[model samples]
Target: MMKKIVPGILTVFFLLISLQKVQAWGFWAHQRINRIAVFTLPPEMLVLYKKNIEFLTEHAVDPDKRRYAVEGEAPRHYIDIDHYGENPFNVVPELWSDAVQKFTEDTLQAYGIVPWHISRSYSWLVSAFREGDVDAILKLSADIGHYIADGNVPLHTTENYNGQLTGQKGIHGLWESRLPEVFGEGYDYLVGKAQYLDDILDEAWSGVREAHYALDSVFNFEKILTEQIGSDQKYSFENRNGRLVKTFSKAFCTSYHDMLDGQVERRARISILRVGSVWYSAWIDAGQPNLKELIKKVKKGKKGAENKDEKIEEEKENNGHKLKIIDRESSDLLGMRDVHEMLFGECEGHGMGVGHGHGRPNKPHTQTAQGQKEGLWPLRMRDL
Candidate 1:
């Protein structure tokens, strides 16, 4: 009886251990992009933004949270442009209607629509500005920031996004979450002022196109590095936020960072500028409304204007673990849990949404994620 029970327990243990949760561009990076983007606004825009900077930063990860709760949220975060063609832009129509007409909404969504979604987000922000709707402006700004940051990530552009196709699984979290958490402090955040976009849709598509161009390097560098260092050395288990996590070693991350030669930093910088620029453009297009007056008109909702430091305090206590709430967003917060191996036994309240935490299996990082063998696909498409 004892032997039988022990084997059953061990089987359950490995099963849990094998389950992995994937997150996109770490939560820290996403929030940081939104927070810093505020400073990039000109005085006209900055006046309003600086007033509500806290709201923008805290809500930056809201889009990721919506993935679990909201329908069609996953596809908005990324695009498997590679699925369309080698030269994706050339084959896929630039306009949303044209794309839908060509591929049908179901097929377009069966892949992803991040670039087009950015355009939609931009338009909403413009409307918010035009109407002086403070709530809409802030919400849309935070959301648009999330999408633009996703667009900048090379991993977010591919069919083999998580490296499952090439046996380099976990690369998604490694590149987006770990690298920035380890080395982002040194990155310069002063990206100058935001500028108006003459062609919002064009720029949105450009971001996705450029990201696609860098896809090869994103995969090859990791593949080559793993071969040189071996997986054991490439990844190391260390204590993070009071738990042991298997993540890329500093040496390994450094080597990979060097190989990318500013790719990650460049992408992050572009995300910051784009976020700020789009926000600024929206304000200008809205006829430069008086944001102070607009703020007064904002309706009080479920949560009042709580202390801005609430999130900061939470971050300090959790060491950024709160953001990891399984379904929240991508960051070390959602690093795979070792329930049986750890003294804690089981994760108490790990993820944010229903599918989050211990009960549910990990969902794919993007809805349109393909090449699902070897558990590489964390982002899932319902149709596929």
Candidate 2:
């Protein structure tokens, strides 16, 4: 009788563990922007674009509670040397870790490859339109907005991530999340229609390298100004909860402005404008024609809603390898494997996708409220 009850209890225990992983889709505002931008899909391919949009919107945030916004926060320094044992980069593949294919695949799998992830997302966007429809091009152009915006962020790429070694631990929060949150609205929003970007990987890497290299100045300037920045002047009044919140004061802002010489805000403005331009360019690539007519063309060319669900049935049957986890939903695309290799890289075998890593034990385990709710002891998530 005791043994019979054991299986039931275990079953209930595990299901609840995975519940925490499921929550709001994205933590980054950019991801939220990407969610809304999908609507810009050309009318002809609107339905397909929506499908892809939903995919990205679903898994925009981290599933792990410990690092819910891991990527959202850049690393201030490389991991402690002791953590990696000896000669760190040897074991952990970073920047150029995997072969170009695998590396790119990994990038697409994770958070930092914002531009490529956005690009691959667009492939599904392009597929939604008619083969020859010009109007479909305009919509694709509009979708480029998000990827282009990604290119502007220096933190979007590189190793010395969030000023950890540089001693500015919260710098990631200040620049990427907070600054943008505060001043984004004042920036220019127009960049004009996008133009074709030649050799997208090179462009993306260049963007990464530029942002990565910029870390030097980002840290240096802050350090140099630290002495002059008084606690009171550096922290002042910002309205919050119907009361003023003490925060970066006008003095700090003035010093930051002096150091940047207008570059910080300029880059933000450029990012905003270029996002709009790239969106326009991708549309041009699809051949700027007419929206409604192209919509009819796609409806006739591809299997619309009638055959849509069936397209992914086979991918589902075979080990879940063909499923692309966008936003969080598993989009079972027919040629995801081929395109996955062509655009991103050679994907790992089944179970190697982002956050779904194999053999991880600490992933929250299903526990009844009466079970190990307070804390998990010696048995790790892997053991569980």
What CA root-mean-square deviation does each model show from the true structure? 15.2, 13.0
lDDT of 1 by residue, 1-384 (tens): 455555655765554343323443477888999999999998767767888899999889877755643457789888899898766778999999999999999988878888888988888888888877776788789889999999888888887999999898888888898889788998988899898898888988889888889888988998898899997888788885598977789999999999999888888899999999999888888788987666656634213533321333122233322321121222332334332222222312111212223565644354122422221224212211
lDDT of 2 by residue, 1-384 (tens): 446545644654454345332222213444554455454434544544455565544333322222322233222111222233344335434333353354454333443444444445355444433365443333334334445444555654444456776666655555665554555455453434334553444454444445545555677777777766755565678885588655556566557656756555555455444443344344455565455565567677565644544433222332323432232123222222232132323323211144322343434434334332322222222222
Model 2 weakest 10-residue run by lDDT: 73-82
Which candidate has the highest TM-score of all? Answer: 1
- Model 1 clash number: 10
lDDT of each: 0.75, 0.44
lDDT of 2 at 193: 32
Q: What TM-score should be assigned to candidate 1? A: 0.72
